[model samples]
Target: MRWFRKKSASTTKTIFGEYCATSSVHGVRYFSDPERTLCEKFWWIVMFLVSVGGCVKLIESTWLKWNLTPIVVNFENQPISVTEIPFPSFTICPPGKISKLMYNFAKEAKQIRNSGAHANAYGSEDCFSTEFE
Candidate 1:
Protein backbone atom coordinates (compact mmCIF):
# COMPACT_ATOMS: atom_id res chain seq x y z
CA MET A 1 0.00 0.00 0.00
CA ARG A 2 2.85 2.36 0.82
CA TRP A 3 4.48 1.62 -2.51
CA PHE A 4 1.32 2.81 -4.31
CA ARG A 5 1.80 6.42 -3.23
CA LYS A 6 1.84 8.97 -6.06
CA LYS A 7 5.02 10.59 -4.69
CA SER A 8 7.90 9.64 -2.31
CA ALA A 9 9.87 12.14 -0.23
CA SER A 10 13.06 11.75 -2.24
CA THR A 11 11.59 11.11 -5.76
CA THR A 12 10.71 13.93 -8.14
CA LYS A 13 7.36 13.92 -9.97
CA THR A 14 7.44 13.05 -13.68
CA ILE A 15 5.89 15.03 -16.60
CA PHE A 16 2.75 12.86 -16.48
CA GLY A 17 2.17 13.75 -12.81
CA GLU A 18 2.87 17.44 -13.50
CA TYR A 19 0.37 17.28 -16.36
CA CYS A 20 -2.20 15.62 -14.08
CA ALA A 21 -1.64 18.17 -11.34
CA THR A 22 -1.90 21.09 -13.81
CA SER A 23 -4.87 20.00 -15.88
CA SER A 24 -6.86 17.81 -13.42
CA VAL A 25 -6.13 19.30 -9.99
CA HIS A 26 -5.47 23.00 -10.61
CA GLY A 27 -6.28 23.97 -14.21
CA VAL A 28 -9.73 23.70 -15.80
CA ARG A 29 -8.26 22.26 -19.03
CA TYR A 30 -9.46 18.76 -20.05
CA PHE A 31 -8.03 16.10 -22.36
CA SER A 32 -9.27 15.63 -25.94
CA ASP A 33 -9.81 11.83 -25.39
CA PRO A 34 -13.31 12.04 -23.81
CA GLU A 35 -14.52 8.80 -25.42
CA ARG A 36 -11.51 6.90 -24.05
CA THR A 37 -12.48 7.82 -20.48
CA LEU A 38 -16.12 6.98 -21.16
CA CYS A 39 -15.20 3.57 -22.55
CA GLU A 40 -12.77 2.82 -19.75
CA LYS A 41 -15.44 3.55 -17.14
CA PHE A 42 -18.38 1.78 -18.80
CA TRP A 43 -16.82 -1.00 -20.94
CA TRP A 44 -16.92 -3.89 -18.47
CA ILE A 45 -20.38 -2.97 -17.20
CA VAL A 46 -21.87 -2.82 -20.72
CA MET A 47 -20.01 -5.91 -21.96
CA PHE A 48 -20.95 -8.04 -18.93
CA LEU A 49 -24.63 -7.06 -19.15
CA VAL A 50 -24.78 -7.67 -22.90
CA SER A 51 -23.09 -11.09 -22.52
CA VAL A 52 -25.50 -12.11 -19.79
CA GLY A 53 -28.49 -10.99 -21.88
CA GLY A 54 -27.16 -12.85 -24.91
CA CYS A 55 -26.77 -16.06 -22.89
CA VAL A 56 -30.35 -15.72 -21.62
CA LYS A 57 -31.62 -15.10 -25.16
CA LEU A 58 -29.65 -18.06 -26.47
CA ILE A 59 -31.20 -20.35 -23.87
CA GLU A 60 -34.68 -19.02 -24.63
CA SER A 61 -34.27 -19.42 -28.41
CA THR A 62 -32.99 -22.99 -28.01
CA TRP A 63 -35.96 -23.92 -25.84
CA LEU A 64 -38.44 -22.36 -28.27
CA LYS A 65 -36.92 -24.02 -31.33
CA TRP A 66 -36.67 -27.47 -29.76
CA ASN A 67 -39.55 -27.77 -27.28
CA LEU A 68 -42.10 -25.06 -28.04
CA THR A 69 -42.20 -25.25 -31.84
CA PRO A 70 -45.17 -27.29 -33.15
CA ILE A 71 -43.76 -29.91 -35.49
CA VAL A 72 -46.29 -31.93 -37.53
CA VAL A 73 -44.18 -34.86 -38.68
CA ASN A 74 -45.50 -37.44 -41.14
CA PHE A 75 -45.41 -40.91 -39.61
CA GLU A 76 -45.24 -42.63 -43.04
CA ASN A 77 -41.92 -40.93 -43.89
CA GLN A 78 -40.15 -42.04 -40.70
CA PRO A 79 -39.37 -45.42 -39.08
CA ILE A 80 -40.80 -44.43 -35.66
CA SER A 81 -43.66 -46.69 -34.49
CA VAL A 82 -46.97 -44.82 -33.97
CA THR A 83 -48.38 -47.09 -31.24
CA GLU A 84 -46.66 -45.45 -28.22
CA ILE A 85 -49.29 -42.92 -27.12
CA PRO A 86 -51.44 -43.99 -24.13
CA PHE A 87 -55.15 -44.06 -25.03
CA PRO A 88 -57.37 -41.73 -23.01
CA SER A 89 -59.60 -43.47 -20.45
CA PHE A 90 -62.58 -41.31 -21.31
CA THR A 91 -63.76 -39.06 -24.15
CA ILE A 92 -63.77 -35.31 -23.53
CA CYS A 93 -67.05 -34.97 -25.45
CA PRO A 94 -69.72 -37.11 -27.16
CA PRO A 95 -68.46 -39.54 -29.85
CA GLY A 96 -70.67 -38.30 -32.73
CA LYS A 97 -67.80 -36.47 -34.48
CA ILE A 98 -65.62 -39.60 -34.35
CA SER A 99 -68.38 -41.81 -35.81
CA LYS A 100 -69.10 -39.30 -38.56
CA LEU A 101 -65.41 -39.09 -39.48
CA MET A 102 -65.10 -42.89 -39.62
CA TYR A 103 -68.23 -43.12 -41.80
CA ASN A 104 -66.83 -40.49 -44.25
CA PHE A 105 -63.48 -42.35 -44.41
CA ALA A 106 -65.22 -45.68 -45.17
CA LYS A 107 -67.34 -44.09 -47.92
CA GLU A 108 -64.29 -42.47 -49.53
CA ALA A 109 -62.28 -45.73 -49.26
CA LYS A 110 -65.16 -47.61 -50.94
CA GLN A 111 -65.32 -45.08 -53.76
CA ILE A 112 -61.56 -45.47 -54.31
CA ARG A 113 -61.93 -49.22 -54.48
CA ASN A 114 -64.87 -48.99 -56.94
CA SER A 115 -62.82 -46.69 -59.23
CA GLY A 116 -60.45 -49.41 -60.44
CA ALA A 117 -57.21 -49.59 -62.61
CA HIS A 118 -58.76 -47.40 -65.38
CA ALA A 119 -58.72 -44.49 -62.92
CA ASN A 120 -54.93 -44.79 -62.36
CA ALA A 121 -53.85 -44.68 -66.05
CA TYR A 122 -55.46 -41.27 -66.75
CA GLY A 123 -54.51 -39.34 -63.55
CA SER A 124 -57.86 -37.88 -62.40
CA GLU A 125 -58.58 -36.45 -58.93
CA ASP A 126 -60.61 -39.59 -58.14
CA CYS A 127 -57.55 -41.78 -58.89
CA PHE A 128 -55.41 -40.14 -56.12
CA SER A 129 -54.51 -42.10 -52.99
CA THR A 130 -56.36 -41.64 -49.66
CA GLU A 131 -53.25 -39.78 -48.40
CA PHE A 132 -54.39 -36.77 -50.49
CA GLU A 133 -57.74 -36.84 -48.69
Candidate 2:
Protein backbone atom coordinates (compact mmCIF):
# COMPACT_ATOMS: atom_id res chain seq x y z
CA MET A 1 0.00 0.00 0.00
CA ARG A 2 2.81 2.48 0.77
CA TRP A 3 4.59 1.67 -2.52
CA PHE A 4 1.34 2.10 -4.42
CA ARG A 5 0.78 5.48 -2.83
CA LYS A 6 4.29 6.66 -3.80
CA LYS A 7 3.91 5.40 -7.35
CA SER A 8 0.57 7.12 -7.82
CA ALA A 9 1.89 10.40 -6.48
CA SER A 10 4.87 10.33 -8.84
CA THR A 11 2.77 9.44 -11.85
CA THR A 12 0.33 12.20 -11.04
CA LYS A 13 3.16 14.71 -10.70
CA THR A 14 4.65 13.68 -14.04
CA ILE A 15 1.37 14.03 -15.87
CA PHE A 16 0.46 17.30 -14.26
CA GLY A 17 3.92 18.70 -14.87
CA GLU A 18 3.67 17.84 -18.54
CA TYR A 19 0.25 19.42 -18.79
CA CYS A 20 1.39 22.55 -17.02
CA ALA A 21 4.39 22.93 -19.29
CA THR A 22 2.44 22.62 -22.52
CA SER A 23 -0.48 24.54 -23.98
CA SER A 24 -3.61 22.61 -23.24
CA VAL A 25 -7.36 22.92 -22.94
CA HIS A 26 -9.82 20.98 -20.80
CA GLY A 27 -6.95 19.05 -19.24
CA VAL A 28 -6.16 17.73 -22.67
CA ARG A 29 -2.93 18.86 -24.25
CA TYR A 30 -3.67 19.93 -27.80
CA PHE A 31 -0.13 20.70 -28.90
CA SER A 32 2.61 18.81 -27.09
CA ASP A 33 5.06 20.33 -29.53
CA PRO A 34 8.15 20.93 -27.40
CA GLU A 35 10.04 22.19 -30.45
CA ARG A 36 7.75 24.72 -32.02
CA THR A 37 7.81 24.98 -35.80
CA LEU A 38 5.37 26.10 -38.47
CA CYS A 39 5.72 22.75 -40.19
CA GLU A 40 4.96 20.71 -37.11
CA LYS A 41 1.81 22.65 -36.37
CA PHE A 42 0.64 22.40 -39.93
CA TRP A 43 1.33 18.68 -40.04
CA TRP A 44 -0.57 18.22 -36.81
CA ILE A 45 -3.51 19.87 -38.45
CA VAL A 46 -3.11 17.82 -41.61
CA MET A 47 -2.90 14.57 -39.68
CA PHE A 48 -5.94 15.46 -37.69
CA LEU A 49 -7.99 16.18 -40.75
CA VAL A 50 -6.72 13.22 -42.75
CA SER A 51 -7.70 10.97 -39.90
CA VAL A 52 -11.26 12.06 -40.53
CA GLY A 53 -10.67 11.61 -44.26
CA GLY A 54 -14.06 12.80 -45.44
CA CYS A 55 -14.16 15.84 -43.21
CA VAL A 56 -10.65 16.82 -44.22
CA LYS A 57 -11.81 16.93 -47.79
CA LEU A 58 -14.61 19.21 -46.70
CA ILE A 59 -12.52 21.37 -44.35
CA GLU A 60 -9.70 21.76 -46.85
CA SER A 61 -10.83 20.32 -50.09
CA THR A 62 -7.35 20.56 -51.52
CA TRP A 63 -5.40 18.42 -49.06
CA LEU A 64 -5.44 15.22 -51.09
CA LYS A 65 -2.97 14.65 -53.93
CA TRP A 66 -3.27 11.34 -55.65
CA ASN A 67 -0.17 11.54 -57.80
CA LEU A 68 -0.93 15.21 -58.37
CA THR A 69 1.84 17.56 -59.51
CA PRO A 70 2.49 21.26 -59.57
CA ILE A 71 1.91 23.48 -62.60
CA VAL A 72 4.27 25.75 -64.46
CA VAL A 73 3.78 27.91 -67.51
CA ASN A 74 1.53 26.32 -70.08
CA PHE A 75 0.42 26.97 -73.66
CA GLU A 76 -2.22 29.48 -72.65
CA ASN A 77 -1.38 30.33 -69.04
CA GLN A 78 2.23 30.28 -67.88
CA PRO A 79 1.56 29.14 -64.37
CA ILE A 80 4.12 27.63 -62.02
CA SER A 81 5.35 24.17 -62.92
CA VAL A 82 3.36 21.57 -61.05
CA THR A 83 5.83 18.86 -61.96
CA GLU A 84 8.70 20.87 -60.54
CA ILE A 85 7.27 21.51 -57.09
CA PRO A 86 9.66 20.54 -54.32
CA PHE A 87 9.54 17.22 -52.52
CA PRO A 88 8.11 16.39 -49.07
CA SER A 89 5.46 19.09 -49.62
CA PHE A 90 3.19 17.36 -52.09
CA THR A 91 3.00 14.05 -50.30
CA ILE A 92 1.02 12.49 -47.48
CA CYS A 93 2.45 10.55 -44.56
CA PRO A 94 1.41 7.54 -42.54
CA PRO A 95 0.38 9.62 -39.53
CA GLY A 96 2.58 10.69 -36.58
CA LYS A 97 5.53 10.32 -38.95
CA ILE A 98 5.19 13.69 -40.63
CA SER A 99 8.13 16.06 -40.38
CA LYS A 100 8.04 19.83 -40.34
CA LEU A 101 9.54 20.00 -43.82
CA MET A 102 7.13 17.36 -45.05
CA TYR A 103 4.24 19.38 -43.66
CA ASN A 104 5.55 22.43 -45.50
CA PHE A 105 5.84 20.35 -48.63
CA ALA A 106 2.31 19.06 -48.09
CA LYS A 107 1.02 22.63 -47.89
CA GLU A 108 2.41 23.55 -51.27
CA ALA A 109 1.24 20.24 -52.61
CA LYS A 110 -2.30 20.94 -51.42
CA GLN A 111 -2.24 24.34 -53.08
CA ILE A 112 -1.12 22.80 -56.33
CA ARG A 113 -3.75 20.13 -55.97
CA ASN A 114 -6.43 22.81 -55.59
CA SER A 115 -5.10 24.72 -58.59
CA GLY A 116 -5.70 21.71 -60.78
CA ALA A 117 -2.03 21.47 -61.57
CA HIS A 118 -2.60 17.86 -62.38
CA ALA A 119 -5.09 17.16 -65.13
CA ASN A 120 -6.12 14.05 -63.22
CA ALA A 121 -6.10 15.07 -59.60
CA TYR A 122 -8.66 13.24 -57.51
CA GLY A 123 -11.98 14.87 -56.79
CA SER A 124 -13.58 14.80 -53.34
CA GLU A 125 -15.82 11.89 -54.10
CA ASP A 126 -13.15 10.19 -56.10
CA CYS A 127 -10.62 10.64 -53.32
CA PHE A 128 -12.92 9.14 -50.66
CA SER A 129 -13.85 6.35 -53.01
CA THR A 130 -10.25 5.43 -53.54
CA GLU A 131 -9.42 5.57 -49.85
CA PHE A 132 -12.01 2.97 -48.91
CA GLU A 133 -12.02 1.03 -52.16
Q: Over the stretch 1-133, how does candidate 1's per-residue lDDT look in tens digits?
A: 5775645632444544456446643221222233347555366446656778999999989988977654445446564433554455974866655666555666665566566753776666455545524
Give per-residue CA lDDT, model 2, range 105-131, as digits (tens). Answer: 555655655566544655443332321
How many residue pairs clash in all the candidates, one count each?
Answer: 0, 11
Alpha-carbon TM-score of each model against the true structure = 0.25, 0.21
Please give the range of 10 consecutive residues that has the lowest summed lDDT in model 2: 124-133
Model 1 clash tally?
A: 0
Model 1's alpha-carbon lDDT is: 0.55
- Misplaced by over 4 Å in model 2 are 1-9, 16-63, 76-133
RMSD of each: 20.1, 25.2
Top candidate on lDDT is: 2
**Candidate 1 residue spans exceeding 4 A from truth:** 1-39, 70-133
